[model samples]
Target: MTGWLDRAAENAHKFAQRNPRAVAAGVMFSLAGFAATAFGVASPSAPGTEIAQQIISEDVQPLPVHEQLEALAAHQLELNRSTAGRANDTADRLLSRLGVNDASAASFLRRERGVRDLLDGRVPRLFTARADESGRLKELVVRMPAERRDQITTHFTRVTLHPAGHGGWKVRREQAQLESQVRLGSGTVRNSLFTATDEAGLPDTIATQLSEMFSEEVDFHREIKKGDTFSVAYETLTADGEPITWNEGAGHLLAAEYINRGRVYQGMWVRDAMGRGAYVGMDGQPKQRSFLASPMEFSRVTSGFAMRMHPILQTMRAHQGVDYGAPVGTPVRTVGSGVVDFAGWRNGFGNVVEIQHDGDRSTLYAHLSRIDVRKGEHVEQGTRIGAVGATGWATGPHLHFEFRIRGVHQDPLQVAKATQTPMASVSRAELQQLATSARTQIAAARSMGAVRAE
Candidate 1:
């Protein structure tokens, strides 16, 4: 038997050597079959414990069809739409555009005095309306400029009309605190500052602030070159995150850079621990001089301190003050901090205000429609002392501003450049940090503007 087994093994080895590929394939197939039987398949369970089973039956009632339908209706779809209130936007018309078909909502809007005023102005207003999927009005809200002119910068008017809990619609009108949103913008002047700002999609208020921020170093009206550029980091006032259209949503100018006639000027707003803040330059000098450059925030220079044809006299005469053409109700501010020396009318300068400042200097604002200060009252720089009007011996509504030294008339434009020391309390580290951030922000704004231009 041993001899026979050895002969068979010798014969198998010879065959394997001749067909090595066939032998390897056969070995792999046998290993895979063994693995599949051992691990890949589950073992069967023993059938020793068999238990008896029983079946039971019952009937269950479902909810009523109406109740199921009511549950679905409770989650009715709500729709929202927004539109601007035009001068010709009636209650029905506005509601129609907002996808509302309810006549009761329109009637309620027409009946309420506060709500009706939303469509009274020619200036378009942003309106948001909520309704059901069936076009029934749910609520209407509109954010508008403040009613009082003085609060335009800090306040906004919010009007809401909705269904009252009792049943009929109720209108709510209130003055809301305007929240400030930080904004960055940049523009290059091709024609004018206003034009550039418009093209750059910047607010008009920012343009005015930029002009005022660099007024001491550059004359925006006369010295502005074609290629002048500006960058600004500022704030825009919003009510409930919605920007108010009127008054340009004006807020504080935080930082600014102006390139006027090839000279680069930069300013950053800085504050101390006392909450007092001011615009300062890169060298930490206050941009505010001894006085502000203009009484109004922004306006066209209709007349300068030169010999010009008098509108009333029809003869060429020396225009002692600058005339800023603006609407009648435009705010007129004090150019410097001072005590009111005169707050009554003069012969030609009707309803005038004269402030006596330090350093033997004084300033006068003429042709004011209303004066907010008395003769003995002390006023600060940039205080609204009055509003512009055509009450004087003049042709139209404008501000006649004059700067005087020792009772002699001087150029109003020159007063803003007068040397004044900066505040001493601001920390050096705080200002440096603020300047670094402002520098980066201005650069970013410029780059963004360039990208948009391209």
Candidate 2:
């Protein structure tokens, strides 16, 4: 067998060498045939049988649409900017401070009769002025108190000074409408009344109104503890057909309630037969007393009304009034409606004000930097009387407030509480109408998140 295999191999090798090209061609053809058979078994369609073709479409243009431009005036798009300033004593000084460069407008306003009356007032009038691009005073407006010879309408004056095309201004005086809207808000005191009200989106002016409304009843500074809550419905002015900003032209507190430390204090605003508004309770009793508990809006009782060692004199003495430690220039207000019996420097009190209220009642404010009222001047309740200071016999800036009756000094806080009058419920017929109206308004307000602007 071995001899036969060897003879066969030798013969094959010899044959391969003689026909190498034919041998290589035969091997390639065998591999190609095997691959083709394997691929052909899995093929879905036979190649070169018939290739399918699809039709191609040409593009077309879109349809046209017509349009036109709207016309707008250049001046209409431009806004007239203004700056507000308080008028000084003289017209020249006020014009200088207000940056009014127009000599013609200045001369016209100075010569105008209405302008002079509007400018001259006990308190400096607030004026708003506007100038054109060339720095010429184009308009000047001052909101003055309306002078009504006969009518009892709630109105004000909008005195406008503008160009008349005759090289001077035409002074126009128009009746300004003092429109008002009722607004509502409720808040819980977490840190402070101001903080909570601010968080509730209430204005500071309204917050001040709330404090004043409940001033005689609530001790907002001390008695107002955590978890105390309050709700208020008040009027906000819409002045001269313009929207009232948060700080400008704040109206009065219409109604309010303060729930403090297991006690509830309520106030409602109502107009009497004479159309005079007063804050009362739901039962129709006056919420306001003869005097407010405190004269300073925001203060701390650093030194109570008692015997204490005088800081400056270094001696034991009776501190007849409460000493509220505050920064200088804090506003001091009158506790009640009264006349300014005295507003000047005293022996120990710096800029002192003595207001004599009804029924021989009086209140004293001392240690003031500046006095705002003069002697014999009638001031309303909560009117600013002076600014806090360290005037007179004091070591630092504070308000020494005292409540006196018939020339006898008493504890201000105690006097405030004692002055509260017993509230009497209104008649059933009258109560039904007022309560229904109030409830309806409050419910409407509660359902809304904010006051709707007109």
Name the top lDDT candidate: 1
Model 2, residue pairs in steric clash: none
Q: Considering summed lDDT, which 10 consecutive residues are worst modelled in model 1?
A: 51-60
Stretches of candidate 1 off by over 4 Å are: 1-78, 122-124, 147-149, 165-167, 271-277, 290-364, 367-425, 452-454
Residue 359 lDDT, candidate 2, scale 0-100: 43
How do the residues 119-168 of candidate 1 rate in per-residue lDDT, one tens digit apiece? 88565478888898778878888878777644666677888888875448
Go through the candidates in order and give the C-alpha RMSD of each one to the true structure. 29.4, 36.5
Q: What is the C-alpha local distance difference test score of candidate 1?
A: 0.67
Give the poorly placed runs of model 2, Cα more than 4 Å off.
1-83, 86-140, 145-155, 174-177, 198-205, 215-218, 243-250, 261-266, 285-362, 365-431, 444-454
**Candidate 2 lDDT score at position 21:** 47
